[model samples]
Target chain A: MTDKKMDIIRALKRAGNNPISGEELGGILGISRTMVWKYMKALGEEGYVIRSSPGSGHVLVSAPDKLYPSEIMDGLDTSIIGGDIRYFDEVDSTNDVAKKMGSSSDEGTVVIAEMQDSGRGRKGGHWMSPRGGVWMSVILKPNVVPAYAPRFTLMAGVAVAKAIRGLGVEASLKWPNDVLIGDKKVCGILTEMDAECDQINFVIIGIGINVNVLIEELSEDLRSSSTSLSEIKGEELDRIAFVQALLRALEDEYIRSKTSGFDSILEEWRSLSSTIGRDVDVVTPQRIIRGKAVGITENGTLLVETAEGLEEIVAGSCIHG
Target chain B: MTDKKMDIIRALKRAGNNPISGEELGGILGISRTMVWKYMKALGEEGYVIRSSPGSGHVLVSAPDKLYPSEIMDGLDTSIIGGDIRYFDEVDSTNDVAKKMGSSSDEGTVVIAEMQDSGRGRKGGHWMSPRGGVWMSVILKPNVVPAYAPRFTLMAGVAVAKAIRGLGVEASLKWPNDVLIGDKKVCGILTEMDAECDQINFVIIGIGINVNVLIEELSEDLRSSSTSLSEIKGEELDRIAFVQALLRALEDEYIRSKTSGFDSILEEWRSLSSTIGRDVDVVTPQRIIRGKAVGITENGTLLVETAEGLEEIVAGSCIHG
Candidate 1:
């Protein structure tokens, strides 16, 4: 149903400034030219800007900046992750949606939303998810122990950093799962899972990227610490292209972690780490440790050389000192 | 509503062969004599045999072998676990019920069933749960890491073994979570959990004990490896009493694990261990290892001393050699 409309939109997108003829779209979609014309009218209603001249056919001017499945799937190069994408205009949390999904859902299924009402970070901390940000969660059924869950968070952080860096933007990973730009946070990763003692049932890695969000819209307290892509770049980013790259990068890392092991990805993580080699304050639930950030453990815990000794903090809030 | 009937049943059972006057039952229930008689009639319809005489008020002749909430709750002394028991005549699996339960469910909630249509062990291995067995799951939301999950399995094994031993039966715990009577298995535990890398959402400890199941009625292959309480005792055992004791024992161990850490329970597990100091073979998903079961690790993994030196097998099927 939406496939024909999507094919026309994709074909028009590929045509750039050139108009794609109705005959060509009809042949591509295996529909009649009359149907193609009807579909163009439908696309216009769906917020697609298509200019049609008397001599030239339909040319795609612009697409609505919506994270719809059709838009995200247009150029998504991933073979697994995001292949079965569920797009929501607004959701309480993409992680919640993924958690409630049945085991029958595909392993690499992804849930995406334009806005989140109750998005959260690790330990149920609130996450600010505006409409312009990429609020998404990827459902992965990795055959690993629940103890090894933080590895996925580390993997996702590396993927996000890699994708952001690929766009010529400088991005770095903070300890645990935060992506930062020069000591300000731009993205946070929350990993949740269900498992047995020996096996993992599934893991939902919630990734909240403040792409086109306005920094001023956040609470005053967060303004100094939190930053978005649009703020750093002084302009809004193409979220659709960013998401395609993110899903592709995430899928690549996820597959690599499964096949080669997490060490390779961990190496990439260390290279992009902003917390390592810095004096930091790691606050766990029990106590706060002031130390020089040393390195990360194989289990994805932060190893900090404190005044007392070297301490391995499994999960915590890392504050750059 | 059922609590009233349970109170009446408990009163009658306390009276033994002697009949409890209607006045006595009414006083204990805080109800009128007529109400007591009506409740007694209802209990009779639900398979309790009450012999009522004109002068000798009412004497409980026998209770049905049903693991009803009233039956199990009558003498259950647990402060936490089994406080909110959901009993079913049959279910696909008690673990499935607990897994499907919402986070709002109490931390120490219990789900019990008389039989499981598709009972499973670790790695989705089939478990034979007959009508007279105690196929149950206990839900615990411990504030611990997901890696600590296997410790709960070990804790549960010790609890089961201790409870069985309290009944004056010779029961021992095998590595990773199996309770054995001599060389045959009488109980198997499956601990499943939902957690993040750092915090646990909840853990459902599924325990399937062959209470009064007839060994001959089991599948031919299972008959040789499995033993039941009836086969050991040469008569049907009291399931209601056994469940009450098991729940109490489990709650004790669970609380100890939370308050004092799992070391104490680990010590008890080691004491009652049948696998330790025995020539054994442990089969894990990755490989098989034959060694003398030397000791158990703090993480609840089996420590086997092999020709290749010491090995810690986290999860596996243990076969006594």
Candidate 2:
């Protein structure tokens, strides 16, 4: 759909269940009245409930809940980060799609799928992304070195946790990149980058959230360690609203990270961190490091106080003591 | 070509211009005499100067000067670095091909081109890859993190410098990733990595060397700063032999780095470095750091002593002061 139609939808949404005259929409969109009527008719055909009366002009009652390109683009508030979103009903993984698209697509382009057939987590583990889960990847072209790429993952974790917390659940961060609710995993973030000699071409941030997935649908082993938003909130949350909130939060954090330093984001992340100050066993390929998670370095490395001394881990799997 | 054909060619090369009987070749290769004769006839048709005597069998007098897959693999000594090589007569860039092939290609696979129409350097600069230049990229699936990827460029610089110095040229290392003779650059290395989170999928080490390129062929601006081997030595060097030495050095350094650590490579790099102990200005996107190069960190970062104090630079373009 064109941006003009989206602007018209936004104007009607801003009116809030009240009718907006075709002349007003045309004036707002800088188009003719005939063009505005044509866009309204097209939107009506695409499952948007628009009411028109002799006295009242046009009211946008509701929009489709399905994550369609037009539906998601209708009310997006960001200037970037989701300006161009590709929606898929099923995919192998949104990250894979984003990686393929990253070479040609503009920065801040998004790829989202309802279900992933072969979703992946950190360290090559499988992530079960069933229906009702938020499986999405965002392409970011940040002007930074590869050494600083890990900090983007931390920023994303903060954004996701903040969005979840905004829904009245106590969401927290796990070391490296994971979001949890009361010791149960609710979101997993996998960040990937394509870089050459210190210069980064693009970074793909893949976020998988168990929004409304049922407990029985999860794998037997993961059922005990994972929880969904509906399970904690005692009701099914609107996926569209949740995704909008998440994207807004992500855009805010991403802009702040690029403009200001990561000091504020790091502070917020540390406060929401569930791993810091906890005794944990960080498993690397070389050896298992048993230490207390003292703090995080400026580069996003976890500073662990091992028996030998202080050790900074760039990548690892953490198991709490 | 098939590995079998390459193996037969290797056996012929091992004979060193001496004729080996067809029966002897068959016995050595565990193949029939007819098969040996067929392979010899095929190699002769492919620009190989093979002499066949009725009783003495076949002898390899010379091979093509072009960087063919068979010619490169004929007598390669490295165990993994060049076990698989893809050769192209002309390409946009070897790095482009290597990045595409890195996903499925095994570690140590190489992609080489005789001429590159659009070779690249660091910071999106164009590299002059005319004929007689060694334009190649190696695909390495090293078990390392993305932060450690820059060290591979330093290691490649060391390897290329060692290979050039072995030929009696005064080759030395530059800051970050460049090889120089005196004050002019002779080789440029671009290292790229595909990574997600903390795990690295693969790294492509693209090395470009101006072996026999004429100085007049370079662009007007690069002519003053860039020097080729032929320009310095006043004679063209053997391109095939130089590539062989480079691969050997790279394979050795790569193996040692994986087994021991980057400490040894760091030591060797520091010793050959022209930037260390010299006053230089490191230009990053954020700011310029002017200081005396003091040392290098284990992660291959340049340690500079500025007026403020000692500073570690992760990625930058160094200019001699």
Candidate 3:
């Protein structure tokens, strides 16, 4: 299915000023003319404005009023992000796609899905992602080792929180990787990275945002804990704009991580985090540590103060006070 | 391919006292009679001896001499190592398979391959694995968070070294995750784990051992830095016995990790480590720290004493003195 769409997109690009007949598209795609038309319609619905005239041919007129590949390629601000977009109608998980692509593809490749069939939260929990939510994963190649990958989660959280705030809705970062409104989770970010002993190959940042999804659309169990931008702002957001803003913010943080240092980024994370200074229970495989969250260290470890003393947490799930 | 093999094994076990004819096997396998014969031949080559009588059909005479699934099921000691074995004639990587299975499969499941098309080393480097090497990934469902994941890498290194030593080969631990023979890497362990804010799902320990690989077969540049058991011992070794020993050692360490404190394991690691008391360069993403390798912390961080002072190295590649 994806292969056919790529063919149509490539065929349309080749046709440029001239029109491509359905017969030629079919021949190129090795499909029937009817199947070609069906694919064209699918592309059109995805915002590809290919003008079709019966018998005459089809001309690439304009793309939809969306940040389609053509639009993203036209003038994407950063060097990465939407530089290479893989749009999927439905996928099990964008992270899975990004992880598969991590070895072969260039860094900064992005995978976007309209909906995720197996959207996941942290700790193998199901992430409630209905239609109209933004489900995407961005692939990044960083020189950092796996130990510092937690910072990518923190960086992504800060970016998502800032991007949500740009929509005029109050959003804050919950420690590790959640963008929340007051106490409800508005967005979640999962960072998956592959590393060698000393260096990292690529990291996939899977971000899910409840953009235009209504509170009523959420499952009853999650309704109280989950909120959407539209529900909070009383208006639907431009998802393309939101994605672009997020990519831009993410690019800035990624650049800092690569070129300058994480000191400023850590400072930003500290300022935006709601997890620090809270009473929390951190459950590791060894034992549960209940403590007051003190701070996040330079290496991206969570520092906790227990009755015994200060302990650094590298990995664990946290329960908020 | 694996699913069909398991079914065939199950069917043969169920029809114990009777010889299953080719026609019957074909009927049960939903494959052609020719395919049934081919699968049986493949199974026989893998160490399952079938007594075939032209008129009476085929009967399982005795188990073959290999550590194939059937034999592994015959009272394998470990809880997780042999529980779920994913055997592959050839794969890009067992770690890749384990990562795919890591999300859904139970802990202790193992993925083993006869050959890896794209085997890898730590830090995104290539791992030279020929057909005779023990290229496998063990899925561990430890309650520990992702930070403690490095400990698994450390434990695997210790296990591999111990298993190699059991074969009468001189082995030494090289800090983080390498088993060495006189400073040349004989085996490498890559540990990948997934975690949420405070909980871990599973850790995949991808181990690559040059069990029977000849040093002459190694890539030209790697020849000096890499050694194989075959080359070191001047003969081929029993891979099944080595795998069993490694798994047993791993089980002991893993059990101790759960029951007792990590003090004993850390002590064993310190004794086996060749890096301790040596001057080395630890290269991380941010900077390089040159110092004397002191000891390993319980969390698996490398403690180094630099000219400035003592420093803890969490994740990095080490260049030993």
Candidate 4:
């Protein structure tokens, strides 16, 4: 059903300013002219503006600002990632939905929502996910143990950081899970998974990017620490293009993780690290380790040089000291 | 409702052979004599055999083999681990139910079912969980990264091995997550969790042990590799007592993990390990490492000494060579 709709969209997009008649579309798709008109009406209902004239036929105008599956298909590249994209107008969380689909869905399946009613952050924190933000989760079935999860987290951080940096703005990665623009966070990555001790069943890499969202949408307590792309750029940016680049970058890093042992991705993360080489306080559950971030271990753990010498922190919340 | 039932059960058990009057039970519970009679009737409905006489009161005869939450509480010794025990006659999987209860239920909440229609094993294998088997999941909210999950897996393994050895049969642990009796399998521990990259929200340790179940209950393919406690001991052991001991052992190991850096648990695992000092083929996601198992790393990773020298295998399925 959507193949024909995609054909019509592609045909219209290829024609540029020139109008393509329903008769031409029917001939191209081997369908009747009435079916072509029906597809056009469906596209119109989806907020795709179409201009129809008597002699010139129909001209494609503009598309909605929503992240519809068909709309994401416009500029989306990659073979598997986002290939089976599921879009929702609203959801409790994309990660929750992705976890449900984990057992059945193929690797790289994507779940996205325009607004999340109860989006989650790291450490049981809440993530504000109003409209105009990129609230999505990518399903990955990596063949590794739970201990190797840090590589995936670093892979996502690098991918999100690269996508944000592609917009000509300097975006750095905070160790473990946050993407920051200077001192404030513009994006966050929450990677959740279901795994046995030695093997992962599936991993849902939830990437929440505040694209074209108002800064006021965040809770008052987090307003100072969070910023959006529109707030930084002083204008709304095209979300469709940004999401395409982000998925592509993520796919690149994911391929690298499997192909090159994630060493390149780890190096990229090191180069863009906002935590390393800085005075920081890592608050682990067992104890607080205050030191200068010295380096990253081979397993993606943070090595900090404390008064007791170098200590490796496996998991913690980091605050700039 | 359950408190009253438990109080009545305790009263009957405390009486032992002496029949306590309904009047005496009511006085202890601060309820009417009629309420005490009703409680006895309820216990009778739950497969509890009771004997009533004219002058004397009700005498508890025998309790059913069912792992009711009330039954578990009788011999349970753990302060936190089994504080909230959930029991079902049947379920898809105890792990599935435990994951749902993990968010709201307190740490160490235990979920058990007599039969699982879809019991899951490690690496997407199926576990036959018919009646007369111990199918359960323990919810653990550990303050550690997913990398440290191996410790919990090892902890559950040592606890399970201890419980099985308590049955007068030697049970040893395999690297990663399997329990064995001699050369065949007796128990398996599957550790699953929901976590962000840096921290774990919850870990569900699913343990499946065959007690009174028959050896023929397993699929034909698994029959040669699997055995039951009843088959080994030539008698059906008391499950309620076994589960109490298992939960107590698990709670002890869990407390030790927090007090110690899991070095002690690792040592216990090493002592009970059937994989250590054995020539083995470790099948990992990336490649296979064939070597003699030398020792365990401090992080519970298997150290294999191959021809290339000592190798640290973080995650793998070990097969004895």
Candidate 5:
């Protein structure tokens, strides 16, 4: 950990139940009081809410930047997820950063970014995230083989759905991988893994959400098929608070998933899935299958009742009607 | 095309069974005769055998650099596949460069390098290519679904094996994706694609070969198992010629696999396979199946005939006895 991260931790600890003097805090961090004020301002810019006083000190009344490390540190109660956060102003991609950190960083470590210049989606598609979006990539060192790793994608879908519902938004999952609001997509999860034959080195789950982005600002194609939290609610919701809820939900779901298996996760996913029982078309290179969406297996495959009988689709683009 | 490339093409054309004059060649390229001498020297360093004289220009006798775009171009008889070449001294990873170029470059352009700072293998393992190895990434715009993109790995494996054997090297293929020399891996292929649910934007095939690598300088584990062409032949082979051969073979195999089907390729793979009809242990995430390596399927899966039953292994590390 760098000295900057430590100072942020110390500041949060010192402000437990009360405000800490900025001058005194600056002295502890071995910087000038003005520098301390600048650090506080930086934290505030990142979403930390430190109430300022003229002579007393700085009070951390509420976590305005809930996803910021300082705000998430003492507030986050999860065991592993978000335990160590590496926040970047701009990066090629959070997934790329997480991947580079995977061998060295512990499991459940998360990398969050304000914006990505090279954000990636499934199959290497460009994920367009300008700013004011929830873009994060989490590193998971699961003790599973590469084939079974796809189940993590399904697990994350369930977690995202639950987190969105917690905010009173009606979000549903589509088969294979998609989170939709009504008929439009609100979020997309990309799960990339590095694995040998039977062993998995690490997996990076990159989740992109439309948080406070304006609909008009989206690309022409995305504008018609995507929805934002602010757009749906007709107001800008607290990003920090939403991310906190999401990380907490993700941690819980991930634990349940690895230990208890995908039964409950699949059930949760099914309930929130809009693709189930819908007429759909799936195209693979070998053949195209059109059928009624029946269910999802534990391996995260979609079971469709096609003309040839029941078939499982490990991956495909889904169009629901 | 740049003037340099065009000048070389014109010089080769003008040679016409007789060497062109240096003064005339310099005039054509709009460079001084001294500059022409320098270019010839650079071309010589790149492994082009140019017959030169005091007044005579130069005659192309042979190519030197294996991964030179001109070599691949000469070998390719297609409209695409080797249209453009981007050579790098060193890169973080070729897949990354290919991904960046994937959206902009033509469908079949290729990126070649002698080394990489962060060369990647399947599952994030280090593809250690100190020097004297083939490290290349080809940009391909294959209009297919993402699920079928894994086929590119299998297809590339066949290409690598075919190209190596065309050089009379005893190269065989391992299950799902690996080109092996005897019992050790000599090459690895990584296929990354960008796609929507049903449509693929592009795919990058990052290939690494242990050609001309000194096995003695390798790590203990690799030193004991791995073998290289130079080590086997006890001499340095022309890399440019080898690259040309490999690209030619790859272009042919790619076309066959994508257009005709995997049946012909599977047959070729089976003939070159050393694992089939042998005792092997196949490890997957769900379970371990130990049995006779009976055969490989059209989809590049290993068919293991165990005491329990015959099983199909999609992806796994294979141990053969």
Candidate 6:
């Protein structure tokens, strides 16, 4: 839908049972009275309840609760990140779509899906993406080497954790790219990049959050290990607002990473990390290492103090003891 | 274009000036005499000089000196490297084509072009790829993190140097990915990779070698800094034999790197290196580091002992002081 329809709906909602004149809307939106009426009519056709009178131009009764581009972009304050978003009712995977578009897409382009038929996790794992999850991917073009690419996963984790904590929830960061609510995973991030030797062409960051999914919606295996925001708060969240907050936080962190450095994001990640200081088992493709998760390196490698010594683990699945 | 045709041609060339009977040729190739006659007719149509007599079947007078897939694959000893090659008469860049195919291609899939319209060098420079040059790219699916990708460039350099040295030329390796003769570059390599988080999906190693380009054909600026095999050896080398040797050496080094480790390759690289022990200027995107090139790290980073201290540079352009 057009932003004008959204603006008209928002204006009528703000009026709160009072009638708003078309002239006032035209003045507010810098459009003609006829254009305002056209927008109101469009909004009414889109299931928005509106009433009109001779003197009172329009009044809003209710609006749809769907996550439309206009709804998500209503108050998005970032200059990038979500500036150009493609919304899909259903998709195989947002990451796949974003990856296909990444080479030619502008930096900060985004793709979001209402539901995914083939959502994926790290190492070719399947992710259960129900209707209530926020499945989105963003494209970024960073001027960095492939070695420094893993740090973007940490940056995304920190951004997601900060945004979730902003809603008064105790969200913690997991090693690599996960957000946890208490001991259960609430979000997962997958970062992929295309690079030519030392220079990166583009990176696609896929973020999937269980915003309002019910516990029963998860598969039997994941039911006990996964928690949604609605399950933690005992109520469904405003998904549009949550997504806006997340995009803003991610954009801010991305800017910080590009302009300043990743140190601040790394510090924030360390503060929210749930893996540090815990005895853990990290299973890499080659072998498994048991150790205390001591710290993280600048390149986003996990520093584990094992019997062998301090080992830097680049990739693995971690199990806490 | 077919292996059968190539087999007939190879057999006839091996006979020198003698003509073998069609029955014997068919028996040697496990085909009927009519099939051998058809292949001879097709080869003659493709500018190959073949003569047939009633008693003495067919004889090859001369064949075009082209780097066709059949020619390169004829008696190729590598188990991998050149097993599945996609040959192009002309292409924009072999690296670009290989990168596009990398995700779906097999581990040792290769792309080669007779001439590149827009061949590229490292750091956004143009590579002059004439018809006689070897412009090729190989796709590798290594089980390693993206941080270890630079070592493949070193491995490729070693392979190319060893192959050229086998041809009786004193070929040396430059830091990162250049094969040089004396102070001039005779070959350049560009490595690219796709990765997700901590795991690498695929790597494209693009190798461009100046095999038989004439010295006078080079641009005025490049003439002083570039030299070809024909220029150094005073004759046009056999393009098919050179590619076979290069692919074999590359496959050997790749297997060694995977099965044993990169230490042996590193030792060979160090011995062939023209940058080691030289006072060098390493120009990274961020800054320029001036130091004595003491050694190369296992990850293919240049170990530069600067005035400040020792520094490991992951990616950059190197210049000897």
Best by TM-score: 1
Residue A130 miss distance in model 5 (angstroms) = 6.7
Rank order (by DockQ, best first)? 1, 2, 4, 6, 3, 5
lDDT of 4 by residue, A1-321 (tens): 288887888888889899988898899999998999899999899888989887668889987888877777777879879889998999999998898778789999999999999899877778999999999999999877676766777898899999989999899989778999989998988888877766788899999998988888778988999888899999999998899999999999998888887778888899999898999999977789999997887577899999999999877888976
Query: Across residues A20-134, which tens digit of lDDT does each residue of candidate 2 receive?
Result: 8999889998999999989998888867898887566888888865677666765779888888999888999898888877868998899998899999998678999999889
**lDDT, candidate 6, A210-267, per-residue tens:** 9998879888999999999999999999998999999999999999988888888888
Q: What is the lDDT of every predicted structure here? A: 0.88, 0.88, 0.81, 0.87, 0.77, 0.88
| Sequence-dependent TM-score of model 4 | 0.82
**With candidate 1 superimposed using the best TM-score fit, by how many Å does residue A273's alpha carbon deviate from the native?**
1.1
Candidate 6 per-residue lDDT over residues B1-321, each given as its tens digit: 888887888898888789899999999999998898888888888778887889877778777777778778879988878888899989999988987788778898889988999998876689989888999999999978777788889999999999999999999988988999998989999988878867788999999999998767777899998999999999999998999999999999999998989899899899999999999999987899999999998888899999999999987889988
The Cα error of candidate 4 at residue B158, in Å, is 2.5
Interface RMSD of 1: 1.1
Q: Give candidate 2's error at residue A288 in angstroms.
A: 5.5
How does chain B score by TM in each prediction?
0.91, 0.88, 0.82, 0.95, 0.85, 0.92
Better of 5 and 6 by TM-score: 6
Per-candidate interface DockQ score: 0.61, 0.51, 0.29, 0.50, 0.15, 0.48
Encode model 5's per-residue lDDT on B185-229: one tens digit a residue.
Answer: 888888766443334567788888888888876777778777887
What's the residue-level lDDT of A137 in candidate 5?
91
- How many clashing residue pairs appear in each of the predictions shown? 0, 0, 13, 0, 10, 0
Q: Residue-wise lDDT of candidate 3 within A133-215, one digit each (tens)?
A: 88889988876656677788888888888887787777887766788898898899888766543455677889999998888
Off by over 4 Å in 3: A1-74, A182-184, A196-199, A270-321, B1-67, B182-184, B197-199, B223-227, B231-234, B277-293, B303-321
**Residue A74, candidate 3: how far off, in angstroms?**
4.9
Candidate 5, position A320, lDDT: 89
Regions more than 4 Å wrong, model 4: A1-62, A273-298, A302-321, B1-64, B273-294, B303-321
Docking class of 3: acceptable
